[model samples]
Target: MKEYEQNQQKNKEHYEKVYANYNLNNILYWLNNLEGYLDFVTNYETSWSALYQNDFRNRIKGKKVLEMGCGDCNNAAIMAALGARVYANDIASTSGKIVEQLNGSFDFSHPIVFVEGDFLNNDLASGSFDFVIGKAFLHHLSLPVEREFLKETARLLKTDGEARFFEPAVNSKLLDELRWYIPIGNRPSKFRGEAFRKWKEEDPHPDRSFSSAHFKKAVNEFFEECLIKPVGTLDRFRNLIKNRKWNGRYAKWALKNEQKLPLFLNSKFARSQLIVGKLPLK
Candidate 1:
């Protein structure tokens, strides 16, 4: 079987396990699906709130933003609040609920639409967005598809448009050793607990870290400058101090400020990687 089909099958099997367990329930699933999303009018309002106060709004504001693979609209909501015309698309049905919540929360909602489709094959208008954003989406593809993903992103962007991307960067050595006995798969991102629980048995690739290198090279090939930034030490160490469901940790966002501590100094091995790339201005 082809690798993409195989990954899809494993993902399907994993979801089946998740649904069968169901003890975790949909609300948790919804929240977990939010990944970097903090709850406002919902779960962890503090987490969501801090993200906005920091550097998020300052970054992608006042642009026509397209959040590709946006499952829950949290990132889209952030951009929308910053006065961007935000558009999002995902293959899940729950995406509708996310847009509804976003519409209810914000006062000055710019144009926002959520469509359901495969991003790889979907025929979106070329150069539709000034900015395209995806959180933890690209590494899901194998190599050739990764190349195509960049080409597609380039096609969709106008000459000077940008793509804001967040991906999981690996430690390489640590994960490579584990791949020998473990049936290594291409990736283990997105709700890593669930990824481990789901595709744990099927892993096979040993030396593969599936970092943002592919994203950098892919984007750099088309766009002028590709910057890969890292985030999430706060999400990591702070989770130990306070559980959001009970005692919400104010320190989660604090841990990521590399200007303070050396822990977050490097992009690789950080909890997540963010790449902001753009086509050269003419």
Candidate 2:
């Protein structure tokens, strides 16, 4: 198989394992207390905060929204709860099961439709969505696959529609190289030789560019407007805090203040970014 195809299969296998015994109780609780949950995501969580910036949580209600690479269905359920006609696509069939469970339990204004299997093959009509979004999703794909997904995003949305993605950014090679030496969670430091190699072998992400410049250029090819917002520059440091509550508090503060840095510095230092692409070049 080609690289993209291999990556797709790897992702399918990886997420299936990750979501194999997934419980919906937490998701259900959040759906029940959606307002508070929305507030938390909007202000506290790095990925959701960036993706839902500019009053997106308010605007998505009663709109046709498609979520590409909808893993675990948390965001999909949240969007549906917010009154969006949500179409969620993922390679993993296990995600479809979560959608079924959510639809069965929640009284969404519009139930989320799980578009199973390859996203490119989905029979979704053209110009059907008001918005297309992927939360921390694009960086998992090979560059070729990422471009294909962008082209599909362009084809899937209305002329005035926008595609928003929350993705990891690696704009500074120095920072990125430093990051590899510091291990997090189960992944060992890159200098750990065989251990790191083994961890990398099982890592689902395809080796590819996650730079802001690369993402901007890729999206610009298909969309007339591309806006890349830096996020989590300081928030990335919250990892050093041992206290969970203190970490959350620091993240909220860091995300808010990080944007005040000069644009060039933010572009170089931000650990993550929000990509907004509009006006599809049809």
Candidate 3:
């Protein structure tokens, strides 16, 4: 198989194992306290804050929204709760079960439609959606696969539709190089030679370009407008804080202020990004 195909299969197996016995208690709690949950994540969580920026919460109500790579279906459930006509896709069949559980447990304005298997094979109609969203998802795909997905996004979206993806940003080679040396969780430091290589072999994320410049250029052909917003430049440091409350406070402050810095600084050093595409060429 080709590299992208191999990565896709790896991701399928990986996420299936990761979410196999997933509990819905946390999601249930959030559903019960929906407004409060939305307020907290949108204000303090880097990925959530970035993806929901520019009044996304308000705009999606009663709109057709497709979520690509909707792992665990938490965001899909949240969007459904917010009154969007949500369609979610994921390679893992386990995600479909999660969606089913959410629909059975909650009374959404419209139940989320789960699309399983490969994204490119979906029979979704053209110009059928008002919005397309993916949270921390694009970086998992190889560049060639990503281009195909973007082309599909253009075909599926209305002319005035928008695509929002919150993804990792690796704009500075120096910062990225240093990041690999500081191990997180099960992954060993890059200096670990064979150990690191073995871990990378199993890692689901494909080795691909993640620069904001590349993203901007890649989407330009499919969409008339592309905006790349840097996120977590300072919020990335919250990982160092041991106190949960303090970390949350710092993240909110950092995310808010990081945007105020000169664009050049944020573009070069931000830990994550929110890429927005509008006016689909199709």
Name the candidate that leads on TM-score.
2
Candidate 3 lDDT over 1-282, as tens digits, reads: 387677888899999998899999999899889999999998899899999888888999999999999999999999998999999999999999999999999999899999999988999999999999989888888887889999999999998899999999999999899888877789999999999999998888877899999999989989999999999899877877879889888988998888789999999999999999999997
Q: Write the per-residue lDDT of candidate 2 for residues 1-282, one digit (tens) a residue.
A: 387788889899989998888999999999999999988877888888899899998899899999999999999999999999999999999999999999999899888999999987889899989999999988888888789899999999999999999999999999999888888999899989899999999999888899988999999999999999999889888878989989889988998898788988888899999999999998
Show the lowest summed lDDT stretch of 10 residues, model 3: 1-10
Error of 3 at 44 (Å): 1.5
Sequence-dependent TM-score of model 3: 0.96
RMSD of model 3 against the true structure: 1.3
Which residue runs does candidate 3 get wrong by more than 4 Å? Answer: none
**Reference-based lDDT, residue 215, model 2:** 96
In candidate 2 the C-alpha lDDT for residue 147 amounts to 92
lDDT of 1: 0.58
TM-score against truth, every candidate: 0.65, 0.97, 0.96
Higher-scoring candidate on lDDT, 1 or 3:
3
